[model samples]
Target: MAQTAGVKPMAIAGRVASERERCIGMTDAERAWRKQWLKDQVLASNEPVHVEEYWRERTNPIRRIYRKPLDVLFTTLAPVLGQQRAADYRYITGKLGLIAVGVLAVHYYFKYQGNDWTKKGGWRMTRTKPMVLPGQPGFPYKSERCKDSDYADRGFSKSVFGSK
Candidate 1:
């Protein structure tokens, strides 16, 4: 391949190394066969063929990403925890763990974080006692019903507390 005018040598070498790494596991014969197959596919197709699309079409996308991590987890735990226990742990953590974490996060947010406004200056409970209306049994000592004199003077009248 012809080198571009200002590109560094290391950058070119890194690109070639990355391309080879994509085919790392194949034997030389298998690599050659795949190369020939890809070339034939490109030649045969009327539309442009993408390498990523070719791989994704043949493999299960979910299995491809999940298989490696789950295998490592199970293998590491199997010897120490026993096979059945390890399998159960994997099932709980893989499926239920995420759901539990999400629920706890939502609960915490609503109970604490979501009430930030109440902490700043919003409505709040007070230590002061509730007001008692005039002429009620506790009016003289406990009532803070009004600051006006007419309400205080009218206290204990026959009209308020029905005649005995």
Candidate 2:
């Protein structure tokens, strides 16, 4: 609430306040290029700079990398799909891609690094300890007894469920 005299809150908050402030350390060519970029990309597109900046920060690098290609696709298909439909397709595809990536990441983690038992060279489906129960054959010590399958092979079927 307490703002400095003759200075906006943005300047006080370490943001370059205006074109002049942004140009302070830049060479003439750099300044001209920057001004042209702002004019063509920001102003011509009718998108607010702050809103664009917010989305840039919020989205991950993967999405940013895919954005241009997707934009070109939608733009090219715009005549057939219409503007609204093209936008919807773009949005849906982006979200679905994100979801697919997330699902694959989780699948990879669970497949390899998700469980402590796996890390310790134990059964993938169960923990390190054997799943032997009272009144069962190999009641306490034999790990092979706890597994649902009685296969003697050294794979998924041989291991039993356990916490430890």
Candidate 3:
């Protein structure tokens, strides 16, 4: 590799180091082999390949990026908690746990005796009815239902309801 005429030695070395880091210590031969193998695999693959495939068109990147943080967290906690238990702990204490707490809160909110401003004084019961929203069309809340909704809306609703 010929260095530029005016480039400093340190700068050249840094550039070489950066390039080396890109290949993770693999030699020129090894990098060429890997590239050739990838080309062969792509050519041999039955399915057509898209060069500009998106995050939607490819899932591996999405999966890896999303799980990286959780993986680090679980590994960090695994020694103290045990691997299986660490994973379980993350599952139980993460979003799922928040969901459990939310459900419990809703349940207690509705079912608890004299909660929700009915018992403003906090310990005593009152027969106050649940407040109604302005848009509610009365007891059954007669509202227009959609026969067909947009795909994007459906996806948004799905994620909101906790499906991956």
TM-score: which candidate is best?
Answer: 2
Weakest ten-residue segment in model 3 by summed lDDT: 147-156
Q: Residues 1-164, candidate 2, lDDT per residue (tens digit)?
A: 35567665442213233656676776677667666665654453644444877888988989778698888899899999998899999999988999999999888877766545235553445447667779988876755355554343334343574312
Error of 2 at 63 (Å): 6.0
lDDT of 3 by residue, 69-97 (tens): 77788889899989679988777766775
Could you tell me the TM-score of candidate 1?
Answer: 0.27
Ranking by lDDT: 2, 1, 3
Candidate 1 lDDT trough over 10 residues, lowest sum: 115-124
TM-scores, one per candidate = 0.27, 0.38, 0.24
Question: How does each model score on lDDT?
Answer: 0.61, 0.67, 0.60
lDDT of predicted model 2: 0.67
What C-alpha lDDT does candidate 3 achieve relative to the native structure?
Answer: 0.60
- The C-alpha stretches of model 2 lying farther than 4 A from their native spots are 1-64, 116-164
Q: Which is the better candidate, 1 or 2, if ranked by TM-score?
A: 2
- lDDT tens digits by residue: candidate 1, 2-51: 47567655532222235566556656766676667556655544455558
